[model samples]
Target: MENSTQITIENIQYSLSDIEKDCWSRLVNGAVKSRSPFHTPAVATFGQKEISLRTVVLRKTIPETREIRFHTDVRSRKWAELLSNPAISALFYDASTRIQLRLNGLASLHQHNDITNDAWQKTTLSSRRCYLTLHSPSSFSDIPTSGLTEDIEQENLSFEESEIGLKNFGIVSIHVQSIDWLWLHHAGHRRAFFDYTDGKYQWMIP
Candidate 1:
């Protein structure tokens, strides 16, 4: 049988503004800490035939501008999708907290720009190896492959060789337009919605 016990959290009443503040705080932590539940979020973008969704590593969050950053390969379908239609959605959930944050935003790609340069500089050669793939993401092949040359995939490349991957690297920055926050509890579930573009917020049925 499943455990019937509800998780009890510490006491503290939160106002709407407090909840918003906490959301951004958690986002910032997620970008820097790999252990954070928010460290990886699912980002969705409009694709050619259907809505595309994929898991992305949380790179950075700018509360001042309500923007979130993620890195990707410029040759990937997602990068192309964002170029055609910037509309994007990001989702973050913390099982322990029973909290879910659903965000709608417009995403812009950055490449051969300062943003990409800064992000690229922060990454190690191992992480950059993905960019060294011989073909764009989702390219059909006779045999399955990671898309990287043997040396690159095997971590046999030096920093000089790894630099080649920078040409395929880029960053996606999302300008948050709205947020739907949901909380689950045994007593009752709570939900709130914040629309930045509309400059309004409200409680909603969970």
Candidate 2:
């Protein structure tokens, strides 16, 4: 029999194990259903000589494939950083469950391709406005603005108007290689580490 434990978070019960499968299942559930911003993970990428971290929304999760996706502007600094180095780390914490997940993975960027086109097609016009900016993300400006052009009315933009933003849209797919799961409790803490590349799963002292 597989060793398991029952835990409750936000009135939902989960039968978890000291393995990658259960942990990944819970993570997918959190990303898809959790209303908290904790679902937005902090992704760290290799910078010039150091590591840069930024919070990004979790757009999709594929447990079977061990992949997660997030959208971004192709002109963003992080996009450039990922292009230089695909290796990255993502951190997620759920306050309600007191669970922390650290994931290490390789990211693939999709731009001006079928992947980007599919993602853009599913995005709403309002959300697409961010990619229609007159300048690339993080550009220096004398004045602060919403990033969109002064003449472009936010709510009035038509589908064709939003289509122009497709050129700036990009999708990032992270293929997870390892995951570290930690749970905090007053009585005792539990932790587990999983390495998919080596097919190893073990409990760690917490």
Residue 44, candidate 1: Cα error in Å is 0.7
Clashing pairs in 2: none
Instruction: For candidate 1, write residues 1-206 as lDDT tens digits.
Output: 11222212356666677677888999999999999999999999998789999999999999999999999999999999999999999999999999999999999889998888888888998899889888888899999789888877789988887898899999999999999989898887878888999987777889
Cα lDDT listed for each candidate: 0.88, 0.82
Where in model 1 is the C-alpha error above 4 Å?
Answer: 1-9
Number of the predicted model whose TM-score against the real structure is largest = 1
| Cα lDDT over the full model 2 | 0.82
How many backbone clashes can be found in candidate 2? 0
TM-score of each: 0.94, 0.87
Instruction: Give the per-residue lDDT of model 2 (tens digit) for 1-206.
Output: 22355545445554434245656666676567647544689999996888889988888889889999889999998899999999989998877768888999999999999888888999988789888888898899888788776656446778887898998999999999999988898967878778889987777787
